[model samples]
Target chain A: MRASRPGMSRALVRRETIAGYLFLLPSLFFFLVFVIYPMFMCIYTSFFDSNMGKDAVDMFIGLGNYKELFQDKIFLGALKNTAIIVLVSVPTVCAFSLWVSSAIYNMKPVFTSAFRCIFYLPVVTGSVAVTVVWKWMYNNYYGIFNYLGKSVGLIDSNINWLGDPKYALWCIILILFTTSVGQPIVLYVSALGNVDQTLVEAAEVDGATKTQVFWKIKWAQIMPTTLYILIITTINSFQCFALIQLLTSGGPSHSTDTVMYYIYYTAFKLYRYGYGNAMGVVLMVIIAILSAIQYKLGQTDS
Target chain B: MTTKKSALYKIIAFVLVLILALLFTFPLYWILTGSFKTQKEINSTSPAWWPSEWTMKNYENLMGKMKAPLWEVSVPFSQYFTEDGTATVVSAGPQVPGAIRWMLNTIWMAVAAMLLTCLTSALAGYALAKKRFIGRTLIFTLIVCAMALPKQVILIPLIREMSSLKLYNTISAVIYPIVGWPFGVFLIKQFAEGIPGEIIEAARIDGAGEVKTFTTVAYPMIKPGVGALAIFTFINSWNDYFMQLIMLSSTKNLTISLGIAKMQAENSTDYGLIMAGAAFAAVPIITVFLIFQKYFTKGITMGAVKG
Candidate 1:
């Protein structure tokens, strides 16, 4: 643990390097084999026209998949749907969790944890389980939504919630919102707890209103947490696959098609490996850009 | 005057959150209740909020659909010893429901993932935190960047790689990718950084080797972080539907979540049967989350701090 002299010792450096790599070997093996290797292949395979099964050839078709991706209406539609999901879910998840956290963060510890667990139930309940139950609730014939809507005179007839394009995407969004709030709520609660209490007390002593104190003092302190929440929520919403695949299968005229679901459908169902890889590359780039922008904004605000 | 108004606002907020909590919990409530409803009750257009006729018919039907051996064990490299070079399989007892088999497979996958990830991440994280070695900064940066990438971005290539390794459609394929992810390594590194340098130096001064020092001193200090990572990985791998769906296709290899999804797809209109499947997939994992809620929360907050 001694500090290095002006002239370093080469043998000590060699010993440290060997020891470090020895410890890193097992984890590095898996990381290199699974993560780094696949990342290279994902980018490499995007230029070829590959398919599943042995007889199918991976023909070199430079820029062909990307060119088609731009012109394909279905791909464009899927992109737009993904955008809608990200836009709708990210802001609402942040705002809703912030509100819920502020309301419960100062309560009794038992009450606070209870509310947190309750909000997190849907997430803890696996997505396939949540989606199937929701599909039943949205059923055309026996759904509770239809029954309650008719009973309250909200609609004259039963609505085909998942079968109609108009309601299908919205239904998907509602389910996504439920599964999306758990971690953000947890983050916000801890962030709010870490806010400077003396500043809030000083503002209160000067007769600042509750709303004023929240915005002026607590808001600035939690901006970084908010930014983290925003990015994770955005990434999660963008990767909303299980719900769509389980509930709608991007059906009812492909109204609920998303980039993640489309990538799965193309790669597995249609066997268009190259095309799917191209979509994946685009999705990754978009997420990287969005996260960068959020990071930058969060820094400026703080 | 201000105190009274603030008190009123607080009351209103409490009421609103209570209502929202009820709404949030309603889906799970519906699932639990609906699983017990009779076919006649479930199909009623009027919708019974509470089941007038509770029955085990749905579960009975589910169990009757498919059956697997009660238990099976296959030894690694058994194929090489066989006359025909085929793997040897050992079975125990009578046949049980496929749901039981899926549950067993899921538990095994989650546990294996947890153990492997914890062991490897602890070793790597300790090294990254304590060792001043060449390329340490680059490796740490790579792990962080890889953690940020959405998992699906690697799915297509992963399938191909699995096939090349002759591991396609196996439980190990799914488990490996889950463990291979770098988030655990990063999380454990954050925890390891808290270990005082003097302790490590003392261990070395006492003639302890690197492995002994890590095992005796470092592991005890970071045990809580490892606990958090274990439960976190378990729940996530159990619920990782996209990976499970892509990597496993055979009925015998399927996880409970995939089993439920398949059932729902086939029996689209049979709400009673599907709810039974959903309940089966959800209950055990939710129980695990409740038991380890504290560690799980810590893992999440820690990840976010670096993220």
Candidate 2:
């Protein structure tokens, strides 16, 4: 009986090994073929001077794409635009959503959910649909913004929101702000709900002011959610592609040229696959660094 | 005094939220109403808050512009079909409105992606959570790292890869990449971890085989996670315009978002027609979203908490 018991346990372990591998097979097939292979090729192809069509052979031009990217004026401008967007959108999205969540999370469940759905509508509306509508709304000749501005006496003359470089990036940022807030608000609401109410009541009983209670207790408790919101918003802002592509097409002298849009333009339009992949690599590195920095800051804050 | 001051602050906050809500709802509202507005009404400097004369002209123009087959089904290893006792070689079917075709394609793609992602992720997640398998931690770490990487960074290579696989210009190309994304796996794993090991051991003691134990015990426990992942995948795949734009080129295969994008590009100044297209794309997805909002919210929270 004792001898058979050891053998039986060994058999069971072997069966588990087989079963575990069987469960992982389907997902691993896709992950390997689509995700892992592409990721490898993205870095590998960046070293060559590659282009489209079968006749063209990729020439090894070690660091040539990266070298050219630094000197390319358009690429530099795109990088600047990307930084501006990430800088502007991340804080505003975090603050606005935090405020909105704090205000509404305490409301009745019906009202809270209704407001949540309304804000998320723009996101669920899909980027293409949202961009098309915004294109109409920013029309120079007949848009509600111009009409409203003229009526309210905010401006002396009608302004072209998207056609001018001065307002174009900001216009993209505004639409981005609307879409970015929904997820943060949802997260913030839940985080706020999870805060220790007993401690909050204790603080209140001890004559702590509202701001004091918020800044001292609730804020620290929700630091992790805030950090997550910051990282995601930064990433989303950095990758603001569909809006720029559909609304501006990186036009008006490339004022709205983000790294994402430029990458698309280079690969698809100009067929500079290697150069585009290099830009993509740089973008990934930047996002990784920023996320790490935010994580460090979050850890210190708590 | 504090009570009165708080009451006033609450009222002010309520008003602000109400106004913000209106602003947020305006674009979708505009899409719906503008779809019904005539060109003259659309171009008027004094925009109509609500349409005075609602018409279907925009939708009519949109439908008339493009035509495709209502449906096309391929039979494996068969070239001909019998209609009225005569062998007829298969060809493209009769023409239908392009918008309808786009809608159909979008729905089919989203549903396929959702089903595939849920199935694969659930099995993988159950293993990662419950099975004491070698390299489980390594696999989980790889998935997390990949999730952090922005998807667009890999698009150029993915395009080349898909072309090499002869999957370009096909909906499957779009669907496969989305399934390959590991967020669903991560999410389902989080939920699967909550399943008690005692129950699973009990099932094993009862002589249930591996697959049988999973189907009977693990699956029932992870059904909510699967539901969350399904709705999340469906909504995300439906809205994934960038991938659809890159992968699909043929008019008949265009998803609704891509169709609207092309329409807007061609008719840059035709707000009415664009709005009609946008409305068509937005309404169905929004309806799906409204119905499954609970599951979607749960998915987001669950993913974030574990993330």
Highest DockQ: which candidate? 1
Judge candidate 2 at residue A198 and give its lDDT.
Answer: 96
Tens-place lDDT per residue, model 2, A87-152, is: 899999999999999989999999999998898899899999888888888888889899889999
Fnat per predicted structure, each in turn: 0.78, 0.72
lDDT of 1 at A48: 93
Candidate 1, residues A174-216, lDDT tens digits: the string is 9999999999999999899999999999999999988999999
User: How large is the interface RMSD of each prediction?
Assistant: 2.3, 4.2
Kindly provide the TM-score of model 2 when superposed on the true structure, using C-alpha atoms.
0.95
Q: Name the DockQ score for candidate 2.
A: 0.55
Residue B182, candidate 1: C-alpha displacement in angstroms:
0.5
Cα lDDT of model 1 by residue, B1-307, tens digit: 8789978988999999999999999999999899999998899999888988888888887787667676767777665577754457875547888788889989999999999999999999999988888889889989988887898889889998887676777789999988889988998898899999999989999999999999999999888788878877988999899999999987777899998888887888888888888888899988988987877777777677743
Model 2, residue B289: distance off in Å is 1.5
After superposing candidate 2 on the true structure, give the runs of residues whose Cα lies further than 4 Å from its correct spot: A1-9, B75-91
